[model samples]
Target: MTATTTGGLPVALLLPGQGSQHPRMATGLYSGEAAEPEFAAAMDEVFTAMGAAGKPLRADWFAERPTVPVDHVTRSQPLIFAVDYALARLVMSRGVRPAALLGHSVGEMAAAVLAGVFTLPDATALVLDRVRRLADAPPGGMLAVAAAPGELEPYLGDDVVVGAVNAPRQTVLAGPEAPLEKTGQALRDALFTCRRVPSLTGFHSPMLEPACRGAEELFASVPVRAPRITIHSAYTAGPLTHGDVANPAYWARHPVAPVLFWPALDALLSTGDHILIETGPGDGLSRLARRHPRVRAGTSKVLPLRATEHGP
Candidate 1:
């Protein structure tokens, strides 16, 4: 069942982070008429684990309009994680073996679990704790900047940090709201587009230090193991070592660390002309991957399963 391929090219699964979630994003995957048995069962396992952990997921993911807005990190994170993994299972059930896995931000939870680094329950527990800590962090803002990391460097101070480098020109900045706005204004002045991200707290920056600490404490109790599949680390921007995957300290660094998506994508493309599939809801990651020079130069194709028709 794992031999499925479009053109004999190995497949790489790309999982999106928070901002990619939308209302009823899993509707197509879980509708009675379309539901795959493995997807449904995987969701059941997630729900059961959530219930037993006493941190029951309350959002109606199938709602025509999600009761929990996309900006609300607490409800959004676990829901997105659940849906992403369920969708990934559905894809695999169809015989698409993921030769490698790359996930952005919270999406890494699904990648980690699927890679056999942790059980569903342990991952759910970790997600719950991580969300709690992020909720406790000081309020901040994030902006998507259409400029290179070097061009944006002069604008960064103690309050500003590069949150993510999604592509060569697409970088995300996180910090206080005022600083973010100021930086955006500066970018606009320089003829670069800068849009505010729909998030209440700035993640992947020093602002999350306290939250990172709490995450470390939570991860200490959860068992970590070597991954059965290849998982490109957004933190390290390359393949993860068994020691890196098994260390709680390494996992803890993810929250406060900048997501090195550009370098990681470079590393993945350097391997070969691989097929890149966004295993989750939105095609944001896929779109970014398409912009990579290697993907454009090589014969690789990028497909996003159940992705929104239009995305950033």
Candidate 2:
């Protein structure tokens, strides 16, 4: 980790979660004529780690048309995991390694795999199991709201809850499809600027409780080791410790807890000037990180690894 602190600025890899990767996002990146050697090789390694379950994933990703919607949780999280992991690998291939990793949402699991907290196979199993458990969960979506979480409190409930705190005003509300739609319309009526977050289920809310409860035991069998690379957790808004992984409850909180990305990022940048590289396809996180005073003051930086981000 010390080796990556170039010129007193350690490179920090930002792992993105679900909303960062869309369906068909990986279609042309690592397969067919558009295949990139480093990326393709890394993706191949991911597929191999996933074993037989990865076939459909590769097929749907590379297919001109897919059997299931690419945004389905069954495929999206795993796909995001694949793209994020490969993108990080591609960047590392260029000899720029990260001293620390910070995962946003589903990206947290990806960072664990990259940080050696979980072996590839172990992380793959946990991801696949999560996908399976949530496959039948109530269909839901997310709304990006241009308001503080407190200002939006009246609209939140057991159904609709704060999903991500990307910034002071850049909050996302997620819940079941019907409730979310109702809340979106309510926000619109109240004249709040908002947009839809594509392909996201009821993330960071109680709406996912059933699924989370069903698979709460999955992590018990998956061994957790201390991270080789430092990891700043979104949940704790600080560095992760053995306490966070002492039980399976922490992992189970993923789908049902708010993503405190901004707070975690605040803690990260507060430590020192660092290069925050978005090791994913989009610049969503980069956009948020750039709003920080450190980056705004030119003391820190944010770069997108793959600007090949697809739009909804």
Candidate 3:
């Protein structure tokens, strides 16, 4: 962590979730004016860690086309984590130190590693283990629903659950594909905009209990340290305690837990005069941060590092 200058703008770094990933997402980061040696070094460290774990990230990420589809959850999850983690390091290398950090879904794994909760190797292993278990999980799907969770609960029964609460009006539903398709149609008929997310696993629902259970041993084997920086958690939807980060049980359950990003964004904005930077490939976090009442009420500025036409 870098020291904050007196009277400098307080910045919050945002790490994105799954949907932010793309083919060769890392290529542009290495050539930009904002690029730094540390960024490339961090990429090396990440790839080395992945290779040591028996999965070479560079071969897929830098290939003409990925040998394995980049969007496959098994591959995508770790690749996104690596890109987001490297980008965050790049930003910090340029002296844009964040006073706080926040990560959505798989992004939290990178957040934990950034906060010093786990070494890069340990975090990589944990992600791979979780994805491995989920690959065997039953077929399921997710739906992006443009409605409040409370308004949509009637549609959620045994087979469906709220996967994420992204905004006051935007929520995601997760469950078996059959039921999710039916629910998406009903929501569309009710004049709510609904779209099926391109995912085969119903993450954040009870359907992932097996994956969660399978991760218990891996989570326990990993060593943890208290965070060196403040990191708001989507899993807890608030500031993370040392205990929260240190507990293997909390991590094991994270996959099946709803991503409470809306509340987490509120928590970040409540801190005075924040500049929220989306440190990954997309502007999703920036878009969500701008929607918060605090940003609208004039306490924060939302910025996107990767989306700008010019390098930082």
Which candidate leads the pack in lDDT? Answer: 2
What TM-score would each prediction reach against the true structure? 0.91, 0.93, 0.92
Q: How many backbone clashes can be found in candidate 1?
A: 0
By lDDT: ranked, best first: 2, 3, 1
* lDDT of residue 272 for candidate 1: 82
Candidates' lDDT values, in order? 0.79, 0.83, 0.80
lDDT of 1 by residue, 10-104 (tens): 98888888777766666555546665677767777787788753333534565556555656777678877887788788778768788888989
Index of the highest-TM-score prediction? 2
Tens-digit lDDT track of model 3 for 1-312 = 332433466888899886777787766555566555666688778877876543456777777777777777776788778878988887787777678889988888898888888999999888888888887888887888888999998888766999999999889999877888888888888898888766778888998896677577778888899888888999887889988987888899877989999888877776666778787877877887788877787656777876652355
Q: Where in model 3 is the C-alpha error above 4 Å?
A: 1-7, 31-36, 52-56
Which scores higher on lDDT, 1 or 2?
A: 2
Off by over 4 Å in 1: 1-6, 52-58, 64-67, 307-312
Ten contiguous residues minimizing lDDT sum, candidate 2: 303-312
Lowest-sum lDDT 10-residue window in model 3:
1-10
For model 1, state the Cα shift of residue 105 in Å. Answer: 0.9
